[model samples]
Target: MSHEHRHQSHPRIVARLKRAEGHLNAVVAMIEAGRPCLDVAQQLQAVESAIRSAKQTLIHDHVDHCLDARNSEAEREELKAITRYL
Candidate 1:
């Protein structure tokens, strides 16, 4: 799903996402190379963990900035939507 453009994601979150993208690419390469099932499974798990960590970072940032004051019902609902996906 698309997020708001005004919702400025932190630099660290971007970096984490970039790293996760690299991990995903590596997993694709392994699949193409005829890797064993267990090896590929481990790599997949690593990607999942990375994505989860990234999600947490974004959630923390949103809570600290956008939702800190508890104003803006729309923003709070949006943040809730983001959290449910995680």
Candidate 2:
């Protein structure tokens, strides 16, 4: 089977990443504004969580919609490559 990838969740994932980008910008502004370390750390954590969630969603979507069981060798390699980020 051909392993042409499809991303059904692209819009949602892009929105999520945009939110994370906004949060990251806020974190940078907070640091420049001399916000307390704890508050900055919390915002940074939120940004990290958002990015992680987006990544997992993308990876899961790829595995669900792209992987071909009949092509186990190639699919397994792709799975390993994608999962390394997690």
Tens-place lDDT digits, model 1, residues 31-77: 99999989989989998998898888777777666656655787777
**Candidate 1: lDDT of 16?**
83
**Local error of candidate 1 at 16, Å?**
1.0
Q: Model 2, range 51-79, lDDT digits (tens) per residue?
A: 99998899888777646667667677877
**Local distance difference test, candidate 2:** 0.85
CA shift at 2, candidate 1, in angstroms? 11
lDDT of 1 at 23: 88
Q: Where is the poorest 10-residue window by lDDT in model 2? A: 1-10
Query: Quick one: how many clashes does candidate 1 have?
Result: 0
TM-scores of all candidate predictions against the true structure = 0.76, 0.82
lDDT of 1 at 77: 78
In order, the Cα lDDT scores of the candidates are: 0.79, 0.85
Model 1 scores a C-alpha lDDT of 0.79
Q: After superposition, how far is residue 10 of candidate 1 from its true place, in Å?
A: 1.6
